[model samples]
Target: MGQEREQRPVGVRRRTLLLGAAAGAGALALGTDALATRAEAAPTFIRGADVSWLPQMEAQGYYWNNSSGVRQDLFTILKGYGVTAVSLRTWVNPSSDPANGHCGIEETARLAQRARDAGMQVLIGFHFGDTWNSVGVQNPPAAWTGMTYSRMLDAMYDYVYHSCNVIKYYGVTPAWVKIGNETNSGICRPIGGVGHPDQMTGLLNAAYDMSKQVFPNTPVLVHLAQPQNLTSIQNFLNAYGGNGGKWDITGLSSYAQGGNVPGVLANMQTIQSSYGKPVMQVEYGGPVGKATQVRNSLRAFTTGLQGFGGLGTFFWEPEGYPSFNGYNSSAWDETSRRPTAALDGFLNV
Candidate 1:
């Protein structure tokens, strides 16, 4: 009941470099501040590297099948792949303290350390749940189960503070953060969800206020589900005064790329324009199943997203399959063992 609609960000990106044509040559190597500022003054482009789910996998030594050799250091692997940052999702405390949860602040901090060791910026995804969290579902960490509204808000605050402080404690403040992932239904739904403009605005205001207070230097992004919801996203953010109006960068979750990378890229341009903010594809790209396929899609994806209000992107979870076991078994990868074509897209430019 927050709003019965969907939205997407917008901008039209020509294959040709719009502003910094000469500078926007290979990949991020040439994507310096001067180029970004120049593009922004007129129109900017997104140059990013997706290092989300690789570190832990490499460390644990599952199939991994990356291009650098199955045994190579993943960080070295990441830097060579042209990845400037790594994204990881935090499950609060997933498994019962007794159940032995998977990802925790401590685990994420360790991963962040590896990414930092490779000179990569870290994008910590605070999933806001004690377990696997997503848009259709936004459960609090189990510890906060059955809490009152007043306590719930405090719970959220603690979650934010704990996540940020833990990362900061190790001195790896993320480049950008999403309060919730694909909040197509709005965050903290049902309990303190906003069904009216006034209420939604207050809800967003509170979340944004906490984000700004905690991570002022690092931008906070509010994410929408997909391109189809671009407008509703804009409307909600504008009404709520979050990203569309003030949040630093507009973030998106594009599941379309799997079917048509170009279409997905085109949609990103459109959404970026609509949102009127630097764009970040917080979630996109996934296991292509074949190295050759990865190469083809990644190149087109790289070309399409360049020079048209393209800020950056995190390829969702390039290799998150292993952690999921048989349930998301497809998520696990085969052992091609050298930086996969997906890795090469950012690596070779």
Candidate 2:
């Protein structure tokens, strides 16, 4: 889930609010002033990055330095590049891969604090499984195997609630929360997979309900990869909603290298028009040299979804991690160890 790409021949990877109220007289004047101030304030456009590999990278003694030659952390470098938000993914138990086991709740919370301190909004992605959950893999956690469907649903709710509480304990609330990563086939597996639409919807609702209980104000996103597969996306959402699945936002993953930007833009428009939910390009990346093209694609996506509650875009690991598959096209620039034009796309947007 952290690595949003599919394994290929050294290539390929795909991946608000307001208030009101008032009293009388002097209180009314104060309320009016506050409202006026809020109305006058410019709206925020989210430029985000998913640094789910940061903890492990730092644990391995990797360090990111600023352009000034001063040593800095990943979050600091991201902020300097005009990234306004950071997304982190969490696993139920990453002990299966100890070296990459830094995605537990505590580690994610620590990273979330860093992003928050850097003045960037935080997004929490729950892969649900103990490891990767994508189109090719959506296995349940080792601990969740053999459980009855009912029990699995209960466990989902409990896990989400507990994980969210831990993040809140760290004094960092996520601006957005993804119930599952690249869940085109559905979350968990067998019991929660697309084959069992009812069970899938039940499991999703369980997680979504619990997430809202913990962070009522945060928007919950239902993420799916391969934005070009509009039919699959439409079917999934149809089944989800038909079976009572609910989501506050529609999340997408697209890669310019895959040549799906046009389809992705069309899908975003369809989601907004059909579902009336905000659309977010939660994950996107391509070859560093085509940064300008990627940037234009994102700009078009944002512009299309803007009026229909579009939130903006997030690049998935623009600063690629060698431990992961090490796709050359994904990272900003390997030599400089700093952001390249690929990341500048977001800044420019």
Candidate 3:
């Protein structure tokens, strides 16, 4: 199964522009090297999207042909909607899946390049497996199936280090990297499952450390599904901390239809109050045609999150139109190729 399997029910400095001329003059007076040494500030908020299906969609000859009869790339369309960042998932060997190589490292780098070109930051989410991983399953890559716990941890480190370098080689370094995707039950089955917090924390720690080595400034995230399941999240965090796990951010996945907005809000509040780390809704979706409901739900959800150390929110596959694979819903219109009103909801958020 792919990300679609999640249907199983579990889960700016604008003022700087005006100062540009003066800054440039000052830099020239001080020294050109002085300006080059200044570091860029990170964005205050993260308004993002997960468009991991772009490569697959294009491979199938699908273009963003809007109702206006104009052709535009998906990244361009997303940028127009006020999206400042993109989340992409990477698999060890996606070719093994029927999706035909989507989310593979090479494809992920390609999409990340496009996102950078569109002036959006990248968030590389590693599934740490060959295929989909969620609350229901966390299958190890075929090569890692029989590895010992210690070996698996080392392999995870090497994979994350090399993958980050690969994306960097493509002229884009992810602002954030998710050590694992929706890993509520833990990752790399048999050994790193939730039952084995020691091993799970070891794997997470290895990935986090290696990722930091590559992108020292990037924040590593540990993602979980079912934001409403506050108990499950607390349990995982307790086990993780008890086992000495360390991560910089908390990532979540929730759907309005599956979890109520109030529960989601409460969970976000609890996560921040208990863990003291920023949270981001890494994946969220609702009915395709009920734009108003989707918009209102997100409006309330995002608003609640803002007061509780929330980083931002991302809608999963809002561009999943002309449906491919077994996933279809909460997507932009096929004929218009424009974001549905539900997606347009982000504009105000």
Strongest candidate by TM-score: 3
Which tens-of-lDDT digit does each residue in 1-349 have in candidate 2?
2222111211110000012212233553444345334322327667788888776766666666666656777777777777889889999988735344558887888889878888889999999877778766888888999999978876776677778778887788899889998888987888899879999998887777667656866778899888777888888888998886777778888774435555667777787668656677898777666666766665665555455456778888776645453565554555556555556555544
* Cα lDDT over the full model 1: 0.56
Inter-residue clash pairs, candidate 2: 15-253, 15-254
TM-score of each: 0.73, 0.82, 0.84
TM-score of 2: 0.82
Residue by residue across 1-349, what tens digits does model 1's lDDT show? 1121111111111112234435643442233334334434644233344444454444555544445355555555555556666677777766533113456777777778777876777777666667655557756567767776656655565456555666766767677666666665665556544344454344444455455445665666667766655566656565655422335566777645345776667667876676555667776565546545555556566666665756665665555553433222122245454445555555444
Please report, in order, the local distance difference test score of every candidate based on alpha carbons: 0.56, 0.72, 0.75
Candidates 2 and 3 compared: the better one by lDDT is 3
Residue 57 in model 2: lDDT: 65
Span of 10 residues, lowest total lDDT, candidate 1: 1-10
> Which residue runs does candidate 2 get wrong by more than 4 Å?
1-42, 67-70, 96-100, 257-259, 288-309, 323-325
Q: Which portions of model 3 show Cα errors greater than 4 Å?
A: 1-43, 66-69, 96-101, 257-259
